[model samples]
Target: MIPVELWPIASSLKGELLQMQRPQERFAFIIDCFKTYLSWE
Candidate 1:
């Protein structure tokens, strides 16, 4: 399970990505987020 503190960051990341026009950047952002979460874990 994810930690509570990460929820806001995740939501904000999603929101930011949603407003973006570049699909590649959005995908990379998501991959980076996953990498970050893995590192945190």
Candidate 2:
């Protein structure tokens, strides 16, 4: 699931650009990877 904090930004999107199915899975996967990288501090 997408983070609640990201809901506002995601919800602001409109039209077919935001209509791609299952994009959230990709977005969340990316975020998880990014978090892993950042947490290496």
Highest lDDT: give the candidate number: 1
Q: What lDDT does candidate 1 reach at residue 36?
A: 84
For model 1, state the Cα shift of residue 41 in Å: 0.9
lDDT of 2 by residue, 1-41 (tens): 76798677556643433555688865775577579758965
Model 2 TM-score, all chains together: 0.45
Q: Considering every candidate listed, which one attains the maximal TM-score?
A: 1
Note the residue pairs that clash in candidate 2. Answer: none
Per-residue alpha-carbon lDDT of candidate 1 for residues 1-41, written as tens digits (9 for 90 to 100): 65798789778887999998899988888898789878976
Alpha carbon lDDT of each predicted model = 0.84, 0.63
CA shift at 11, candidate 1, in angstroms? Answer: 1.8
